[model samples]
Target: MDKISRLRGFRDIWKDELEKLRKIEEVARKYLNLLGFDELKVPILEKTELFVRSIGETTDIVQKEMFTFHDPSGDSVTLRPEATAGVVRAYIEASLFATQRITKLFTIGSMFRHERPQKGRFREFNQIDVEVFGSKGPLIDAELLWLISLILDELKVKNFEIEVNTVGCWECRKKFKEVFLSYIEKKLDHLCEDCKTRARRNPLRIFDCKKDECLFLTKDSPLLFENLCEECKIHFNKFLNYLIKFEVKVKHNERLVRGLDYYTKTVFEVKSSALGAQNAFIAGGRYDGLVKEMGGPDVPGIGFAIGLERLSLIVNTGNPKENLTVFIAFVDDKAREHLFRLVKQFVKSNIRVFYDPDSKSLKSQMRYAHALNADYAIIVGEEEIKNNIVSLRNMKTGEQKSYPNDLEYLIKDISYTK
Candidate 1:
């Protein structure tokens, strides 16, 4: 029979790659906790209508990317393509707004989509999603960008830029859409099929199209920044000033209307030059009306999502070396049981211990220890077992010490040395 294989666009992450992802999560959690954002874990599956209403029916996520199906009960459900919709649903259903005046939440999990896989993009991916509700000010917006900057800097990601723009609220988009639709209508014949469809439904999404023809045609088209209403213009400018206060350098991109339809007032993306065309490792913006639209109170919100796969590609996770590793080497079969008991003690004391279960020769066991890059080697023999003592050798320095066969003393000595 042929060997079973993982599905395309799905991968098994382990060793160094898994370590890098873990490091990213660690850094994200540290800062998120410091910022007072509580962690929330939402389900991987949600009602199909949750996304259609929040992400918008015209968006690609709703129209094409979602992994949706009718469950056994015959109700349509979807594996979340992104996290914000589910988070919002939880916020409303749980009535999180009744207590806290402002709520900050973060989640880390897998999301599924059906799009064609490419570099830094996948069908099943992981994201570190952050969201803030009940605050409509630009201060939170700038602070979120600052938080993102801190995470990238700590990860040692180099030459990444923060691109910012305003897609404007629904009222502001009304006027801009008229001018945008006119320009798109004339060039619909030359645009990609996707952009052509986007023009009739969500015209602003035309700017997000990656096709050369669409990009070239929309390059000189009307910009939403120019058409921003007085209120949106003021809000955007204040957001820029707040970003400056946070010392976050930002590039104003007039053409950046992120792939989501819920974004309004402020939109931004963190892109790395190292990742080529698919450079954005982080993307988000304000969705001030999403709460009200989802049948909740009129709460304002903003947040961002970090693509762990894309981020792992660019982050430098330094060395994968973990805690001290000790190898148990025994020369006699009788000593094996004693060493096995000692090994259990070391593990209980929170030490990383390794032992050969097959009673291999001492030389073979030593070689295995060296191969594992263990920090210390504990040698046991019938004589040492009789004496109630063991020989501990520093794998690095080759210095040996005799310690009484006491778990406490052994653990203390190892802890003190390393």
Candidate 2:
């Protein structure tokens, strides 16, 4: 018989890789808590309409990537490809807006998308998502960038760049779309099939294309920033100024329209050169109309999601070290009985211990301890039992000592030595 293997585009996380992921999550939680953001956990499965409505019907995630299907009840459901939609649904269903003037939330979990998996891209991926609702000011936008920078800095991620852009509001986009459409129409023949479809359905998305031909043709296209309305221009300028005031350095990219349809006015991405073509480890923008679109009251939102897989590729978590490791070695049946008691005591005291439950010989047990890189070995036998003392050997120094059999004394001595 053949053994079953993990599905493609998925991976088993363990050992050092898992440790690094945990460290990154820990740092994210620490900063989010300090910034007064509460954690919110949402289900991975959501109604298919939730995404089709929020992420946009013409977006790639809805058209091609979503893992959507009908369940036993015959209602369309999907494994969430992103989090904002689900978060918004929760906010409305829970009537959170009725009580709080402003709400800030952060969530850490897995998202599913059926796209071609690459170095940092996966069908099943993890993200640290943060969202702020109610305020439409540029201050929160700048502050979110600062928070992202703080997290990356704490994780020792170096040489990353923050890129910013403004897609403007719907009214500004309405005017820009006309001019953008004309420019794209002239070069539609030279663009890829996907870009051509985008040109017809959502011309702004052409700027998100990665093909050299599409990029070359759109490089000279009209700039959305230059065409921004008076209101959008003022908001964008304030956003840039706020970033400067916060001492958060950012590069303005006129063509940096993110792939999401809900984005309006401000958009940003954190890029790392080390990650190559898929360099963006963090990306998000304001979705001022999404709340109302999701059947909630008119509210504004700004948020970002950090791809842990891409982040882990660049972050150095260093060697994971155990605080202390102990091994219990016993010689005879009586000594084995004592080992069991000592093991329980050590565990209760929050110590890591290793022992053979099958009553292996003292030599065999000590060898196992050495293999496990134990810090110390506690040897017990009839002699020590009669003497009412236990033998403690420093595995590193090859030195030995005897302490009273009392669990308190042994625990204290081990801790003090450590």
What are the per-model numbers of colliding residue pairs? Answer: 0, 0
Off by over 4 Å in 2: none
The CA lDDT of each predicted structure is 0.90, 0.91
lDDT agreement of model 2 with the native: 0.91
TM-score of each: 0.92, 0.96
lDDT of 2 by residue, 98-158 (tens): 9988899989999999989888999999999999999988889999999998999899999
Best-fitting candidate, scored by TM-score = 2
